[model samples]
Target: MTDYKLGRDYARQQDQNDPLKTYRNQFHIPKDEDGEDAVYMTGNSLGLQPKITATYVNEELESWAKLGVEGHVEGKHPWLHYHEFLTDTMADIVGAKPSEVVVMNTLTANLHFMMVSFYQPTKERYKILIESDAFPSDKYAVESQLRHHGFDDQEGLILWQPREGEELLRYEDLEAILEDQGEHIALVLIGGVNYYTGQFFNLKRITDLGHKYGCMVGFDCAHGAGNVPLNLHQSGADFAVWCTYKYLNSGPGSLAGCFVHERHGNSPELNRFTGWWSHNKKTRFNMRGAFDMLPGAEGWQLSNPPILSMAAIRASLDVFKDVGFEILVQKSKKLTGYFEFLLKDLGEDVIRIITPENPEERGCQLSIQVKNADKTLHDKLTKSGVISDWREPDVIRCAPTPLYNTFEDVYELVERLKKILNG
Candidate 1:
């Protein structure tokens, strides 16, 4: 590991040496009281807007205005097949084949859609497994799924919780749960990265354990899609879903993405909800044509998508393409580690980090547990020009996004936090 140092000069030096530092200019960083860029660190919540997003979005508006209804066939980026353009790039982000990936509805909507196909529960085996601390949206969706199938929501759900006095979920505990109740589990759905703790699960290991118990395995990768490399295909998960708004830097509430392993994609036997878009494009408009479902993840779509939202995604993804994902990951590790190092210097008496310390086991986010602190601390930090977010109770979620965040940003954040705590 490279030796780290304290002080503002060290941070500036690191920024000067950073090859990706120039990328910070491409984003619209929120302004401070002095009209300068704030020490923004909430990419995990919603990424900053890329400078080109407006340009890209405007292109669609112009096409719609000029081409009118013909935009479906004649406009730029043709609305008829617009979603197809995002397929390859999105697949690359989540490490799946184009056939296995599709950009569609919002996150929870896609989760319910995928569950309709993957979470089939028989009388003997009709339970779903998830981490006890999954995002609230995920918990609600799965509970509804369980209730929808005439199962007791609480009785049909199994929580793989952490050990007493521990914050991170242990793989051993999950293995034990599968050993005992895997026979009754119809589905194993988990967050690829825990939103609160920032622990990145071993996707392949979870899938293997679930499959060993004859369960359909899947993941909610809302935080992992653009933050980390999720080899969804090799992980052997039956399906996965994620949003584009956070780390992907797509505009707020942009369409989500879905991944069905190639094994399931080509299998026409799977039960799924479908619509006109799900029909084969060759005869989609025939109206009287037989329902020949388009093979793969695209078959799960239920309606035509909004092109304006997609344009924003395309704009953000283009920036990711320019920087290359692997390089971004490398920068992310270093930036996050530097932020961790600084936090450690603040002393355990003052703060604690709930996220995993290992770079390989977590993304850029580090959940800080400031001792005896409350939402008031978070408010102070925000008032002082640090754009970090607060979770319930006492944790602060600050993420140094590699695409644009600089070492100086991390340094200044800690300095500001220190000042606020002392004040």
Candidate 2:
């Protein structure tokens, strides 16, 4: 293990030797009331805007001003094929083939759309499985799917819950649930990373188990996307969806990504909700013959996308392209590990880190339960110019994102928490 120690000087020294320090200047770190850079640690919620985002978005505005309707065919990036430009790069990010990935609607919308084709339930097999404490939106999406199929929403949802007093869900419990009720389940939809607990699930193992039971498996990777090496294709899940606004550094509410394994990319039997955009490019405008479906994930599109939002994604992805996903992940592990080391030094009696200690099972986020602390602790942290989020009851989530957060940021956050708790 690398030698880690206490004190601000040590943190500053680590930042000095950090190879990725140069990229920090590329983002806008928020300023406190007194005008110093705040210890911003919320990349898990929304990533900071890249400095070049404005320039990229402005290009689309300029093109629209000059070309009007002709921008579809005449603009530099060309609106008609704009989504195509992001296909290869995004596919690379999520470890999927070009034909299997698409940038489309927002996260929940894409989840609903994907369920339209993937979550086909029958009279005997109508149950869906998910973690007990899934993100609210994902829980809502799955529950609605059960009700839409004319099943008892409560009875049709199977929760793979944590043991009696523990906080993390066990895969063994999941195995037992499937062992007893596998045949009754039609879909296995899980969050690739548990948003609150910061636990990254074993996607391949979950996929294999679900498939063994004759179920279609999918993941909502909102927390796992830019934070971990998903290798979604290698995992063999039937489908997956993720939002770009978090670790992707894309703007808020930006377009989400969808992936369909190549095995399903060309399958014509699956029922889908389609529109004009889903038509094959060659015949999309022919307007005379039978509806011709595109041969891959591109077939999921229902409308031409908003160009301005896409420009922001393009700009942020260019930053990722320059640094490479591997490089970002390598730095992420080291930075977050150092943060963990320092927190442990504070003594576990006063604080408990609920996020897994093993780096492989989590991303950058650390979910801390300050003994008996509450939201006031989070408010105090914010007032100290440290931007951290607090979940209800007693947990504070701090994510030391590798892209821009420094070792000093982590040090300052703990120092602030220490002062508040000890005082």
Candidate 3:
């Protein structure tokens, strides 16, 4: 909405004015056959690697080689408390207290772990609610949870689907579902940002509505974490989980994050799966002390962390810290807005964007639905030095990630698409 113009010069000017432009050098942008930078628009799927990631990972390797088992306590950034290294910055990224957030298992694994304590179901309130178009992993996880608890998966799972002929979900629809069946719903788990439509949900509103009906609320912030200002603590949900690879710029398949509201930090009554890492740190090495769980999100740790993955996370977070999240978000809105503007100029009849147009309603990603297009169009774009994501059927997801993607990248992408369409 910044009165975006219709030329490559405009994109270059915006990039020149971008304060976060230099930060792009900190990442290793992929290149095309001609050695030019590829327009990477899939940060929502897997973020680009930080240039310093190798250095950080190597340091851990050196520590392991030099200190052996002593590395647990003696290495630089000691393995004994490696996960703690990420706590503060990660807390700031997701807008949660350090004690409430922890970097641990994979996304789905963390979701299941969180559900073990938060999704306790009785005979009556056993149903779980999720978006109808939720990531397949989440759907599978919830269905398994229902089956494990002796409930009929098909009957117990409630989907908050968009109305016919619509793409974005409505908050009113969610409220109606909760109002009509809230009594039977034990948990309400939603993706913080819908992956396909890129619609950022109102977390606080959802949490309030779910809590009002006596349902435990949580969010799978896999797509929201670094892409948007989640403000998880302010959302007042019981818990949330996210993977660090997407948007977080941690290495692919790296550690994920979990957040348990501070209210449940020391709730002894809550049942959780605990292990050695969850025990009191002071006596953790004693090996004979009773299982006195650590308070807050730390108590959920099931085992020691992978230091290599933590190192990669540390590298990426350092970049986020130096740049400051606010500046990145500011750039994100402008970058995506410009992308939207360019796409809209392509003619609404020729292209459709399913992602919310409101700047506050989405992250950097725009899910484009091209008219009379298929995967071959996406293939052509790739051959034209654009790397993007193709959803099944017809949609293409492109995220102009603020940390690295530029206005020129967005502009060039549309040009390639326009060329292909015209040809």
lDDT (C-alpha) at residue 125 in model 3: 98
RMSD of each: 0.8, 0.9, 0.7
lDDT of 2 at 110: 96
- Whose lDDT is greatest here? 3
In model 3, residue pairs whose N, Cα or C atoms come closer than 3 Å (at least 3 residues apart or on different chains), thus clashing, are none
Off by over 4 Å in 1: none
Kindly list the per-residue Cα lDDT of model 2 for residues 134-188, writing each as its tens digit.
Answer: 9999999999999998999899999999999888888999999999999999999
lDDT of 3 by residue, 1-423 (tens): 488889989999999999988988999999999999999999999999999999999999999999999999999899999999999999999999999999999999999999999999999999999999999999999999999999999999999999999999999999999999999999999999999999999999999999999999999999999999999999999999999999999988999999999999999899999999999999998998789999999999999999999999999999999999998999999999999998999899999999998999999999999998999999999999999999988899999999999999999999999999999
Off by over 4 Å in 2: none
Over the stretch 106-175, how does candidate 1's per-residue lDDT look in tens digits? 9999999999899889999999999999999999999999999999999999999999998999999999
Worst 10 residues of 2 by lDDT: 282-291
In TM-score terms, candidate 3 sits at 0.99
Model 2 RMSD, rounded to 1 decimal: 0.9
TM-score of each: 0.99, 0.99, 0.99
